[model samples]
Target: MNNHFITLGNLGLCVAASLNAQRLFKDHRAPAAGIFLVVCSAALSVLPATISLDWSSQPAALCADLQWAAEVLSPAMVSFGFLWLSDDHFTAYTLLTGSALLSMLTGWLSRDGLSVMSRCMAMSSLSCSLTVCLFAGNPLGILGSVLLSAPALVGLSGTSPLVSPEAAGGLLKLGLIGAMTVGCWAIRWALEIYVQDLKGWDKSNNILT
Candidate 1:
């Protein structure tokens, strides 16, 4: 089902980020195993709770789950971001997280900070891997996929700097990412509703036929 895709996407994000952060740590000659456990555990345990117990629709559930997960988790990541990617350049990690946080902000409008934080990290890492691979030229392109390497998945700590002409510019970027994430979910929500209605109509038509 769509839930499977959403789960895969989330897991993929975690794995990818773990990989990237691992590589960064290794290159820097830091301990990688311990940090990886905390990141992976935090993601696995916390991410699932975001899905509403009443989740009923497929696409609706997937998008909502993703958005909510980001909303709950992002702020923490933002606060401690400098620790992970190990830079204050926004690195690809922080840059993508801005978009993930944006997604959460759109959904909750400022409630449940932890849920928002989760969503932010999950979506941000996911986006970073996708974006880097799409654009990066050589090894840098693969740089987005560090967590996949077994060595990179464990022992992790890093940092990064914020990138933007100004705070407002960064906010603008985050806002845009948030809008897009929400917009995609909104479209999926509407589409799912339409499909349900069509299914109802088809069943009725079948009975008549």
Candidate 2:
């Protein structure tokens, strides 16, 4: 019964990806990024179809491990690919998380007409920003990701046409302040790591500095 349900879920995801692609196609002006996103999504959706297959008397431990890798890790790997390509080669903890976030943003931006392209751009920004956040390897990378993500989040909010100009101004102000704070903290964090290294702290333990 569980296997059947899982199969159905996988099919559902495929259908959803198809529908999104179809909608994008119906609109002549859809951005390439949007089409790319849909393609990636469709590919990711197919990963779970293997769950319905029966392995030939595999050990329980191996089965569990395979299941985890397929259901959890596979999607993340696919999303990482999307993010890496989008950013021309980057790192990340989980592209699947970023992809999930992108999916949410796309759903939120489901308005008709010319706004669809804007949604695609916003989705791209979000996916790229999230990829940066997860894979930041240096102080600058971390700071840049934080700064980039703040604007993307704000831009997502701005999608609501009902937002007043005054509110938009205030949001922009807040975003700038927040970004500055993150920059300052990143600098401070870098300095702390530098000091710790000078003190001969173990690199592994001091990594969080």
Candidate 1's C-alpha runs over 4 A off are: 26-42, 45-209
- The candidate maximizing TM-score is 2
Q: Residues 125-147, candidate 1: write the lDDT tens digits.
A: 44443343344222322331232
lDDT, candidate 2, at 133: 39
In candidate 2 the C-alpha lDDT for residue 58 amounts to 51
Q: Best-fitting candidate, measured by lDDT? A: 2
What ranges in model 2 sit over 4 Å off?
1-116, 132-143, 156-159, 177-209
TM-score of 2: 0.27
Q: What is the lDDT of residue 117 in candidate 2?
A: 41
Q: What tens-digit string does per-residue lDDT give for candidate 2 at 127-191?
A: 55455435533354345334423433343234435445466446453444345234323423432
